[model samples]
Target: MPLGTLDRDPPPFFRQGPSALSKLAVCSALAFFLMVADARFKVMQPLRVVLATVLYPAQWLAMRPVLVFQHASQYFSSLTAAQTAQQEVLRKHSLQSQRANQVEQLSLENERLRKALGLRERLQSPSVAAQVIYDAADPYSRKVIIDKGMADKIALGSPVLDESGVLGQVTRVYPLVSEVTLITDRDHAIPVLNTRTGARGVAFGDVSLHVDAMELRFMAANADVAEGDLLTTSGVDGVYPPGLPVARIEKIERRVDAVFARIYCVPLAMVAGAGHVLVLEPTNAQIPARPAADVPAVVPRRGASR
Candidate 1:
C-alpha cells in the first residue's frame, strides 16, 4: 500500500483506551472519591485491613532502630539524674551533722555559764566571772590561763573556783589575762580539814599519780583519816576561804615501818576541763589585822635613870 494511504491511528487490538493526561485526571478523581468515601462511610475498610496485615511485620522491623535509640537516650539521662541526686543528698547530710554538733556545743556552754552565775550569787565574797582561755604552756606544771587579769582586779593568790569547787589560785597576773595554778600542781600545798573527823592536815599535790591528785603528807600512821573523806579548805592557810571543798580521799597508804601515812586525794573541781570560773579575793583579805603588841613602860628602868 502507498504511504499516504496507510491508516494514521493504531489498529483497535493495539490501542489504549485513553490519553495519558486523560488517564491521570481520571485516576486522581477516582482516588479522591475513594478517600472521601473511606473517610465518610468505611467504603475501603476491608481492603485497608488486608493491606495493613501484609505490611505489619515490615513496619515493625523498620521502626526497631528508632525505638532502640530512644530507649538508650532515656536510660543514660536517668542514670545522670540519679548520680546528681545522690551527691546532693550527701552534701545536705554533712551540713546537717555539722550544724547539730555546733548546737550541742553551744548548749553545753550555756549550761556551764548558768551554773556559774548561780554560784556567783551564793558567794559571800566579791567575785569576778571569767572564762578560762586555755591551759598554761608549761608542761611541767598544772596551770590554766583566764581572760580576767590585773585589769579585772584579779590579784595573785586569789582563789579560783568552778561550779563544783575550788579549782586553783591566781599565781601570775597580766594586764589582760591571769595564770591560775591548779591545786594538783606538784608544788602546790593547801591546808585541809576533814569534814568527818575534824582533823586538820596539809595536802600536797602528789607527783607519783599519773592523774591529777593530792596527798595528805606528814600524817601519823594511826591518824583518824579514812578513804572517801571530804577535805575542805581550813582557811588557816590564808589563801582559800574556809568550807570550800578541796578534794576527796581516794586511797590511804600506811606502811608499818613508816612514821607517816600517805593519803591520796582527788580534787572536787573540774581541774582538767573547767571552761568558766570565779576569781575571789584571798581569804587573808577578809581577816582582821593582827593587833600590834602594846609597849609596856619600863618603870624600874626609868626610876634608875632618874
Candidate 2:
C-alpha cells in the first residue's frame, strides 16, 4: 500500500530544441545583424518602426502593473509625503497668485509714486524675462549668466533685482545671453550708509565666498557703527537707488593697532539663491544725460605711443 504512491511514474517534462545558452547566442547574433544592417545599410527602418509600434502598447501595459504597485506602496507608506506634496503644490500656487497681485499693485503704485515724486516716466525698459542659467564657472569669480541677452533687450549696466532687494548690474551682454557681476566680487564695491545713524561708508567684498557680505573700510576707530545696524544705499554711487537695502552690520572688530574697525556686513538680498530677476532700465530722468563739454574728449598727443 505504501509503495503504490512511489510506483506512480513522473509526468513527462517538455524538452526544448536548443539549450538556453544556444538560444541566447542565436538571438544576440540576430540582434547584432539587425543593428548592423539598420546602421550601415540603412535597411530595417520600416521593420524597426513597425516592431516599436506593435510592442509599445504591450511594453507600456506590462509596466503599468509595476508602477501602479510602486505608487500604491508609496502612498500607503507615509501620510506626511502626501501631505507635503499637496502643501508644496498649494504653496506654489499661492506664491504665484500673490506675485501676480503684487505685480499689479506695484505697477499702479509705481505710477502714482512716479507722478508724485516728479520722477520721469520710464520709457518702459523693453525687457525679457530671464532665468539664471548657472553660477560662475570660475570658483574665484562671483558672477552669473542669465538666459536673456542683447537679443532680449538686455544691456550692460542694467540693474538686476529680485523681490527682496537689489542683486547686481549686468556687466557683459552677448547675443543670446548676458553676464552679471554680483556685489560680492572683490572689485565690486557699493556705497552704503547706516540707515539708523545716517553714517556713510563704502562696503568692500571678498570674491571667495561669492556672497554680498563686505567689510566696511575706513570707518574711524571711534565710529558709532555697531552690530545689527541696517546698511542701505546712500545714493552717492548713482548706480543703486537711495534707501535700497544693501547689508546688515553683523559684527565689529576694533583694536588699538588697527586704524579702522573691521566690520562685516551681510547683504539683504540673496542674489545667488534667487531664480528670477527684474532688469531696471534707467529712464532719461533717472540718469542725467552727459553734456558734450562734460564728456571727456580724447586728443592725440605727439608724445603718446601710437
Best by lDDT: 1
Query: Cα lDDT for residue 41, model 1?
Result: 100
Q: What is the lDDT of residue 26 in candidate 2?
A: 99
Top TM-score model: 1
State the lDDT at 153 in candidate 1: 80
lDDT per residue as tens, model 1, 102-208: 89988987888888888788888889999998998889999999999888888789999998888989999999999999999988888899999998999888768
| CA lDDT, candidate 1, residue 176 | 97
Residues 1-306, candidate 2: write the lDDT tens digits: 587668455555655368899999999999999899889997988888999999999999999999999998887877778888999999999999999999997786565444323322332443344668898798877888888887887767776665555567788899998888877777777888898899999988753343556788889888998899998878776566677677888888899988898888777666667566666663333676776667677899989988
Native-referenced Cα lDDT, model 1: 0.90
